[model samples]
Target: MTDCLFCRIIAGELPSKQRHSSDLVIAIEDIAPQAPLHLLILPREHIGSAADLRDTPAHAALLARMHAVAAELANEAGYGDRGWRLVSNVGVEG
Candidate 1:
């Protein structure tokens, strides 16, 4: 976990310009955004990557909630109709 950058962010050891945070996750605007509107969403739990997910039922619901959160944010920013992309970084695929 010491090697995890997200863990450091959640711990406030690493400086991130955070946008929002809830009990489960934290949302931050990407420092070097790919799009005009880009956000980095991460969970508080230390899940290594997509391969780390074991398809647990709880994880399914959690992912759904995370997507919903992103959707809500996009809609609020008037980007829902403009369209957007949610990228979950999974190891080298990121």
Candidate 2:
């Protein structure tokens, strides 16, 4: 966990262009963004993989938080009333 790059980013040891932050989550622009509006959303904790999500039992709330954040982000980015799409790449590459 100490060596995890994301943990370092969350810890503020490594600089990140954070777009949004909350006590439980953080969102930042993807360094190698494939889309015009690409953001990497992750937990404030060191959740390295999807399996780690199970540890956080309040899954629906987490998703709700993500949706809220995404909507706000989209609006701020001028995605218009239709809003932007939110995708989570499981095992496949985007």
Candidate 3:
């Protein structure tokens, strides 16, 4: 995971405009934004995709936390009334 771009950002090996961070996840502004309030919420630990998540409480909580953070960011960015879309993507193919 050391070679991962998001991991690098999480590890402080690269710079990112972080919006929120916690023990389980991190939220950073998308470098190539598609919306006025675009952001990428990622896990602190590297996982290729949702398929990589374990069917456990910790992993479940991670997903919940990610969504929670996204909602917080969207509302903060004034997208609460307009709503927001959450696209989950990862890796090159993703």
Per-model clash counts, in order, read: 0, 0, 0
Quick one: ranking by lDDT, best first? 3, 1, 2
lDDT winner between candidates 1 and 3:
3
Candidate 2's residue-wise lDDT over 1-94, tens digit each?
A: 4898888888889888999999878999988998899998877767666655664558767877877888889899999586678887664453
Q: Once all C-alphas are superposed, what RMSD does model 2 give against the true structure? A: 2.4
lDDT of 1 by residue, 30-93 (tens): 8798898788888888888877877888788778778888998899889989898887777885
What are the lDDT figures for the candidates, one per model? 0.83, 0.81, 0.89
TM-score versus the correct structure, for each prediction? 0.88, 0.79, 0.90
| Residue 3 Cα positional deviation in candidate 3, in Å, after optimal superposition | 1.0
Considering only N, C-alpha and C atoms within 3 Å, which residue pairs clash in candidate 1? none
Q: Report the C-alpha lDDT of model 3 over 2-94, residue by residue, as the tens digit.
A: 767888999999999999989999999989999888898999988877768888998999999999999999999899899899987655677
